[model samples]
Each structure stands twice: as structure tokens, then as C-alpha cells.
Target: MSRGAILLLAAFSGCLAAAPEATAQTNTGTAIEAGGFVNPLLPSGPDPWIVRDGSTYYYMNTQGNRLAIRKTQDITRLADAPEITVWTPPAAGPNAQSIWAPELHRIHGKWYIYYTAAASGHDDDAHRGIFVLENAGRDPTRGKWTDRGQLKTEHTGIDGTTFVYSGKRYFAYSAYVGPDSELAIVAMANPWTLQGKETIIARPDRAWERQGGRQILEGPEFLRAPNGKLYLTYSGSACWSDDYAIGLLSAPAGSDPLDATAWTKTPDPVIAKSPEQDVYAPGHNGFFTTPGDRETWIVYHANPGPGMQCTPKRSPRIQRVEWDREGRPVFAKPAGSALALPRPAGAP
Candidate 1:
């Protein structure tokens, strides 16, 4: 799609003026009373990661080359918020091709970003790895970012994310190991290096998986449950297939999360496409808390229609996360064919 069209779609997510105490009805048999957020917060692009720092929400996504950041205190305005070119690669290397899934993380009083960038013109060689950016400006919007090089790890990785448990830091990324594409993860000894060889933590072995001629799993986001278990939520099935959905893997707390052997995959998928909602390819998701810490949410992408051809069609979206009776993560279906979710909390 042309750059102009891409921007137009992105603007559609939240480009409307704030409606005053408006009410809307939906097929869900529920009424949105008013002052609630809408969906399809952004029109295009996939692999969305949002970070809520204090009262502000900063969002970034998969831009094939340059990094685009939207800063907003009131997330509902993210679609209308001006886009800023926060960081660009001065000299290209690992972070040049298909720059997919960029996430903002604040580590040790500094802003660190974990994104998947591959060698130019080589998508197969793509590794979702973590890279660091040091910002000196008191405000991220006013400061410049200095690229701190790439992190080293085994396997071709993408969707790099970091988690801290009990005082230890662990990095999680999605990669393929088998002859066919199967997603897995490994622990990092340090942010910049792999701890051990590597372990296959998750895979596409179920009937719901294996869409698009390949069984794939990616966009893994680690969430710690209230029960103290480490839940690694990832997208499975083919990106091009409407069957694409989210799944979960669980590892006990106080165990080695990096040790692939420690985690056990669930027998059934957790989140999948819902025809009733007309939502297809509802995966490649990240988790975050609202600004007021009132609720947890899932930020992901979906194709309004079936069959995923990477065009301006697939767009970023956000929804609130719910829990099952057993305290497992349960996500609802996409709102509808269009985007109507609330802006990220703290969006401008």
C-alpha cells in the first residue's frame, strides 16, 4: 500500500472528535453506556506492543524500516495523535529488513526496546531479537535515542520481549526449530546473550494450528498470573489463515522459565477466530495494564476478511482481557468487521 493510504487507515482508528456522553448498541446484547473506549484503535499494521508509563501510553508497531511512535496521554486519540519518528538505524545490520513487532520497555531507569529486525532483503533469516536504546532526554518525546546494538541468542528469533521474576531478568522471543516452522523460546543469561543452547517451548501441533501450509507460533508475550504461574501467551496457526488464534503455555513460578523443559503447553487453544464475531486471524498479541490499573488488555491485529494478504487490510486493535473460572486467560472475539475499541488508556 502507498504511504499515504497507510497513514489514512492508521488515522481511522482514533481520528474522531470526542463524543459527549454518547451511547451505542451492539449485537453482543450489551450497551456501551458512554465514556467507554472503542476498538480498531489503529487501522493498519500488526504486531502491536503498548507500554503504560505512569499516566501516559506509548505505542509502537511493525514498520518494515523506520520506527514510528505515538505518544498520547489519552489513548483514545492514538489514531489522531501525530506520529513521531523516534529511532532510525544509522547503519543497517540485523535491524534493517521487515522491522516487525517493536515494543517499548523501561529497564533500570532507561528505555529499552525489543523488536525483530532482519538482514535486508532476507525475511527467512529474520530473528526476533532484543535491542537497546538509551534516551537522555528527560521526556522520551523530546529526547534522541542511541542504538545500543543487538542481543545475541540461538535460533532465528522475532517478537523479542523481556520479563522479570523475583529479581531475575528473562528474555523471550519466537523462533522456528523443526523442518517446518514451529515456534519456541529460550532463556537469556543476560539481555545481550543467550543463556543455554535453546529449548522448544511452544508449537503448532493441534488441529486448529497448521494454517497456510505451515504450523507456526509467534508473538509470544509473557504474563505472570495472580496464581504465580508464568503464562506465555502466543499466536498459533498461519498468519495468512483466518484460523490464526492465540494459545497459552504455563510454567511454574520459581522454576527456570528459560529452560524449555520446564514449561508445559496446554492441550487446547486459548483464543481462536470467532466466526460469530466476523473476526479472522486474531493473533500476534501483546498484554498490558490500563493506565489506572483497573484492567488488563490485549493489543493485537486481525483481518476483517478471510485470507491474509499483507496489505493495508490488517490493522492493530485492542481489547480488554478476561479470566476463566480456573483463573486462566480468556479473550473475547473481535468487536466486528471494523475497529471500534477504546484508545489505549492514557492515549492523548
Candidate 2:
């Protein structure tokens, strides 16, 4: 995509946080509604991510210009949580603009945040890459965040997520190396360092990926299913289209992440625009296990309406992670804003 088109995807998610009162649930002028609470724990959230550390949940999305996080014990009431600005880039630098998909991870007893950013004056995929920040303090919001520089992969891209398989560190992200973005993986020396060649695992070669007039394979999130198998779920299609959805790729429990043949792609999208469920362009998801009973939950962003597309109107919604009888994963049509469901299994 061109720079102008890509800016539409990167810029809007940051601005939506300013005007969240568009929905009745956001008004919060009255009681917590009769039957249940609403989806979109927050008004504007794209590529929504959350990491559970002890009793607290740290949340983030595409902030566009700067990096920030919201802290809360109960993610269902995230609108009432405290937002903290953890790191701000310099006015002139490669890691200064179009910040997106900030993932807060506590790796090796230290807090590290991985996010994508473009150059100070550029907004296209060429100038964008993944960067990391380190905070030694136990409390991430209060600590000093030091810039750890970019994760130098073979190609520059966005939405980088890391995982440890077989006791070795690996990084997965969308590489903008071809006609469209493709999911790539590489070995990581540590939390902030990359030390090997990137292997292209999946591409936007399937029909379901060519939505909104563009083929996209971004937002690679690592998942370890209850069945002990491994999966890499990624957002597909153009974010600017209502067809934007999620696709799945699976590998063995203990397989080589750097080998392309180890991963198998699902022909169709696992989750997509469900008008009955009032979720449009549903993509860019993160997973977490509940505090008490360890029920897995998915936190992601979607448009309330189909016409909203990839703009700031995209808000965060969540649901439980379900598995099928065969041990494969299942992503049902999400419960819309009208349905008031119970909080996650162990939320306080």
C-alpha cells in the first residue's frame, strides 16, 4: 500500500482514544446496564494487546505517535483503568512516528515492550520496523523505559510478536518484502536482540487474504493451545476493508520455527466480519489466561459497523478462547455490544 493509504491504518487508532463517548456504554452516566456490561472495554482500540503479570493486566493498542499502556486488575473494567505514558520517541528519528501494536511482555524477570514505528517523516511500510524498550523496575508504569533500538530483520515490517519454543527465543512478524506482507520468523538471542536469518513462514497467497484490494499478513501472535500444540494466528486482508479478519497457521508442539515447511496454513479465515455479531473487520488479537481458573481469553479490536472500516471507530472486544473436539482452536462470532456477559473466569 502507498503511504497515504497506510497512514489511514496507522493514524486513526491513536486519535480514537480522544473521543470515546460515541456509544451508550461509553456514556457511563447511569448504572452498569441491566443484564450485562458491554464489549469494547475501551472506546478506541486497534491491534489491542494485553499481558497478565500476577494480578495486574497491562493493556495497549496502536498509539500512532507515542507509546503508552493502561494498567488494571480487571480487564472488563478497563475503561476505569489508569493510563500511563511509558515512552515517547524523539522528534527526529527512525523510531518516532506511526507507533503500532505495543506488546507488553515480562521476559527474563524484566519488563520489555515491543512495538512498530516509522521514521519521523515517513509513514509507509519501508521505514517501519519493530523496536523494543526495557524497564528493570518491577512496576512497568513507574520504571524508566530505555530504548533498545530496532529488531533488525531481513525486511522491515510491523506487528512483531515473540515466543519461546523448546526453551529457545523466536520472533514472528509481518515482513514487507514482496508484493504484499508475509509472516516471517527468526531466532532471537534474547528479549531485545535478533541473531539469525528470518524464515518466511506464510504469505498472502490465498484468496481470503486479498480483501480491501490488498493482500496482507500482519499481526503475528503466538499461541500455545490447551491441547499442547502450537499455533500462530495472524490478521489478514487490508485493515482498510471490512473483510479484514484473522487466519491460522499451526505447527507441532516442539517444531523448528525457522523452517517454513513446519507450519501449515488454514485455507480460510478462522474469524471474520460477522454482521450478526456486530463485529466488522475483526482482527489483530492477543490472548491471556484468566486469573482464577485459567480460562483462556482473547482480546482484540473491531469496528461496530461495516462502514467504519479501519479507522479509529475500531474498538476493543474480548471473548473466551474455545477449542474443538479435535483439539483445534475455535473463534466464534463474538458477542456484540448488546449482550452483557459475565467477566472472565477469574476477574476481580
Candidate 3:
């Protein structure tokens, strides 16, 4: 792809307007007369992340040049939410180009955003590292986002996410190790600084992870199970290829997160391309709980067809995640755009 094409592909997940509501289901599994929504929540959104704070939901994704956040009470009406441009990079410097995967998190009564960016004129695969912004206010969209600077990792990194385990915080991200990208973890002394040497947790060793001749593992997200099991879900394979999919690595909740040996990788992908549904390259996901905390949902991005090549054609889609008898997550299959699923429980 040309440089212009590459930039377009990287920055296409922009904000969108609201669509009409669809049919929804109630807590009793009965269909409501009105008020549900369909897939492709937005016409274009990649690496989509969402978090619910009380009655509000904050949504973000890769906007390329700057960080923007959409806040709403009803996720089905996300397109109608007011977007705030919280941060803009310098005219020329590190973290001034290719801003992607912006995640909103709250810790210690403050808000923080973990995202990836690179210096100007650098290739997307090179020079990219994780950077953070801190906001003192309780509402992330209403506060000033201060630059906390780039995270100093041993190598270039991206898709940085944080989780608290055993009363301590840890940062997990994808870093380049030799020819392939691997998932690494380090202790966090605070929301912005990483302590101790990084531990390599997972790599692209399986055939599904090495598709398109690109050995890659990126976009690590943390999910905690009800049984106290901690799982790190990540995107594998070359994202530009339709073969891209999601894989899982798990460790007990009490286990040392920095110990690479404690984590076990799933042999196959939990979610992959479903051509019958017209959903391809489905990965780079974030998890959220419904208003009543009764349901779990996965928010991620996918292309409607094969060979979409990471452009605006790659749009955000969501589906309720189910658990098997063993309590392990079961991401059935990617739902087609035409599938009229029930709206999220407790969503107005």
C-alpha cells in the first residue's frame, strides 16, 4: 500500500453518528417491543475499547493524529455521544504520529489513557511505543490530559494495558523481540511508571499466530474471571490479513503476573474469521460489563470482507460473551451485521 493508503488505513476508525434502535431482549429472555441495536455500532472503528463507569460508557479507538473519547449512557446510542478531543501531540517528536488503541482507565481516583504512538516519518512497525496521559479529574472526558511521557521498555512496544492483581498493578503489552512481537509484562509502581525487568509471557508460536508470514502478537487486554482466574486476551497474526484472530493466556488470580511460567496459552484462537457472517480479521478486543453487572460483552473491530487491509472498512462490532460449563469464555462466532441481537442488558 502507498503511504497515503497506509495512513488512511491506520486512521479510519473515526467518530460516527447514531443509528435507529433495533429490537432488544429483557432480563427474562423475552423480546421487547422496541429498543435494540445491530452490529457495526459505528460505520468505522478499529481497536475499539469501552468501559462503563457507573451509568456512563466511555468509548475510544485509533484516531491516528489525536486522542478522542466518546461518552454516553446508552451504548446503543454511542454515535450520539459527545466526543472530546482530550490530547494532541506535538508538531514533531516521538508520539506525534500513528496514535492507535486508546484505552480509558481509572485508578486511584484519577483517569489515565494508555495508547501507542511513533515518532514522525517512522514506519508503523518501527519506533512505536506505549505512551500515557493522566487526568486528575474523576470524569476522564472533562479533565485535562497531562502527558506522562513514553514508557521506557527494553524494545519498541504497543497496545499497553494495565490490570490490578493481588492488590498490585501490572502492565502488559506487546514488544518486539528479535524478528517477532511477543507479549511482555512488568510491575507498575504507579499508573505511569513500570518497575522491574519485563517478563516475556506469550509469543507467536502457533500457526494461527504466524499468519501472513508475520510472526506477531499484539493488543493485549486483561480480563478477570469470577473464579479468580486472570486471563490476558490478545490479537495474533498480521492484522492486515483476514486471518487475524484472538488468543488467550491465563494465570490464576493469585499467581505472580510477572512470572512468565505461570501463564498458559490456548492452543487455538478463541475467535477468528467467520466468512459466512461476513466478519473478517476480528481481533484487538476489550471487555465490559453491563449496567447491572449481569452480562459480559466484547468490543472489537473487524472488516466486513476479506482483503480489507486495515482501512475504514474495518469497523467496530460487539457481541455478548458467553461462558461454558467450565467457566471459561466462549466467544461463539462473530455475529453478522444483519444479526439483530438484543441490546446490552440494563442499556436504556
The best candidate in terms of TM-score: 2
How far in Å is the alpha carbon of 234 misplaced in model 1?
Answer: 0.7
Question: Which candidate, 1 or 3, would have the higher lDDT against the true structure?
Answer: 3
Per-residue C-alpha lDDT of model 1 across residues 10-111, encoded as one tens digit per residue: 211210111221223442223323444556677776777788888877888777666778877766557877778877764556666556678887776777
CA-lDDT, candidates in order: 0.65, 0.80, 0.81
- Give the backbone clash total of model 2: 0
Local error of candidate 1 at residue 175 (angstroms): 1.6
- Candidate 2 on 1-348: residue-level lDDT in tens? 565456445436430011112223433323255323568888888889998888888898877777888989888899998778888888888887777889989998899999988887776767888999999999888879989999988898888999987889999999887668899999999898898788999989988798877778988998887666789989888887888888889988777889899899988887777787688888999888777637777888998887786667789998776676666776656667765555666566
Per-candidate TM-scores read 0.83, 0.91, 0.90
Q: Residue by residue across 106-158, what tens digits does model 3's lDDT show?
A: 89888999998888877465677899999999888786889999988878877
Clashing pairs in 3: 22-36
Task: List, in order, the clash count of every candidate structure.
Answer: 18, 0, 1
